[model samples]
Target: MAAVTEPLLRTERMALRQVTRSDVDRLVLLNNDDGVMRYLDWRPPTREQVVAEVEILLKAYEVYPRHGQLIAELADSTFVGWFSLAVGADGPAAPELGYRLRTAHWGAGLATEGSQAMINYAFAELEAERVVAETMFVNAGSRRVMEKCGMRHIETFHVEFDNPLPGTELGEVRYQITREEWLVARTSR
Candidate 1:
């Protein structure tokens, strides 16, 4: 991992910053909302559970400088949602991208904007080897955001979920962009 210069990631209209324990209340609402958790395997977590999760991630920052979920906010400082960057899934060691937004912010393109920023940081700042993201096959919206970030579909695989959402039967799609590919993308732009 490399040192992060900017504490908050800025896009044209949003800011991506470290999530604080103070964000737990609103985060609970966001995490527990049925609509927000629709594509996930787990249901809404308790307030205490969310707080503990936040604390764990906060502690992780001490070792890995640029790894964690970033809380997204509007330029005006209104909380929107969170975007996550982590290492590997079950197999290879790669940066895994994930996010969840308030229903009110859906379809606003903030997902794509923030995702691109993170991808740029992964390759440009963290000196990452690869960045990957996965979403349910039916999650057209999430898939589109990954596509916009220059990630290509790498696979579609099945995973048994106890509380599988609609379209989980269609399997999950993994998307990725490698460092070499990212550099080519940048030079072509």
Candidate 2:
């Protein structure tokens, strides 16, 4: 068996690691949770969809060793959800940050903690030019987490979805922090 590697990122309450084949069921649960998927796909992903997504995420590691969706777990290995620092449409130099915690773990600051760690990794370890994130304008909680991570509001745009979620009319928001901004914030703290 291949030796398991250390986690990609660790925060006060989470250890973010590469998503393995074993994690698909839990990921399905997370994706299927109505509350958790509210601002996302708007419907639970089928098991096959989850499996395909995991395969794609796993392959991403080969192309970009520092980027891929990761599973988040507690010290005892309890599933919290997942996080990602992916090569965005802007390219590798500006990766996107994303996270999803089980509803049971919400409001405990885990999202903020995990997100801050991903931003730190993007700027400090990967030498990324910028880190970006987006969510529905109505997702105040996610917006606050991005703000706390030092990402400023950069854009508010809309995408026409055939079956849009309830707050889709309000548009979506983008938040970002440049490496320079991250460095300044790091020094100030």
Candidate 3:
């Protein structure tokens, strides 16, 4: 798969674009929300951390556009969340789909919308053979998003974490969908 030069994609009700330094404040707030971080590994990130993360994402665009980060924005320009399609540490051929959304946006289906966009981009533009996503077992919301985006549960795996958050004891679930599966599903629909 080749890198994606374009930094933004539009959805029905949102825009997915590369993160910018200007997004720091909103991102910090989103990351800091305790409700939003419940399934995450750490507490809300500090302002400096947010800035550093945004810079890292920007740099990733240059070196790895095929597997980079994107910010989700509402039609009216509100920063809703961010998503990514990146190669997993385990291998280069497999890309992982991940997303984080503001707590207030939960249950509205924005996660599914944004995720489907990335999944489509992976299969259509990047020619990805497959895409996968993982979430803490207790994070039902995220699990639902993955299901809604047409991914099926592949497995539940346990991994040790130094400072595991609540529900980590339940392990984690991995979901996956292949390009062939996506194509067949779309044709059926």
Candidate 4:
């Protein structure tokens, strides 16, 4: 695995490290699992598809500043999932936060732990003015994770998905927190 330069985000249970080529095998396992992608549009990815996906992500990191996802790993170096702060289609400046983990790790607060670390990195390291997350309305687990990370629901909007999932008709909800809000929340604690 390629070492992340300088600083890294460490939670009580995991370290947020860059997703490198060395993680492709685990990536394939995670992405191909139905439990993980059930709420998303995409289905199981072939080995080749996973390879291409990794290539695309790596290239995006190379071409853009602070534009990549981190591979969440436990102290023992087991892959938990990937959490991202990538540029969103909302605009050139919009960076979206999201995560996808193996079902085995669900309901364990690992998602919130990794997410809070990235939220801090977004405001303190990347100097982002705001951070946002969106998910299908039926994804209560995801919605809770965002809320735990201090993001509040802003709106629910419908998106046309070529391969819609079960909750597609219910639309998607957006949640956000501005840097100002995050800082205040932090200090007030």
Instruction: Tell me, by lDDT, which candidate is best.
Output: 2
How many clashes (backbone N, Cα, C below 3 Å) per candidate? 0, 0, 0, 0
lDDT of 4 by residue, 1-189 (tens): 534433267889988766678778888888876688878756778788878988888898786646578888887777788898987676425579989998889999999998898888888888788999999999999999999999999999998877788878999999999998999999999
Candidate 2 C-alpha error for residue 143, in Å: 0.3
Task: Give Cα-based local distance difference scores for all models.
Answer: 0.83, 0.89, 0.84, 0.84
Model 1, 83-161: lDDT tens digits are 8887655322378988899988888888888899989888887778899998999989999999999999999999987
Reference-based lDDT, residue 65, model 2: 85
In terms of lDDT, the poorest run of 10 residues in model 3 is 1-10
**What is the per-residue lDDT of model 2 for residues 11-33, given as tens digits with 9 covering 90 to 100?**
88778888888788898888877
Candidate with better lDDT, 1 vs 4: 4
Candidate 3 structure quality by residue, lDDT tens digits, 1-189? 112224468889987877667778878888887688888857787899888988888787687766677878776677788888977674434689999998888889899999999999888887788999999999998999999999999999998999988899999999999988999999999
Instruction: Quote the positional error of residue 174 for candidate 2 in Å.
Output: 0.6
Query: What lDDT score is found at residue 127 in candidate 4?
Result: 79
TM-score quality measure for candidate 4: 0.91
In Å, residue 57's CA in model 4 sits off its true spot by 1.2
Q: TM-score, each model?
A: 0.90, 0.95, 0.91, 0.91
Assess the local accuracy of residue 139 in candidate 2 as a C-alpha lDDT between 0 and 100. 96
Best by TM-score: 2
| lDDT at residue 44 of model 4 (Cα atoms) | 77
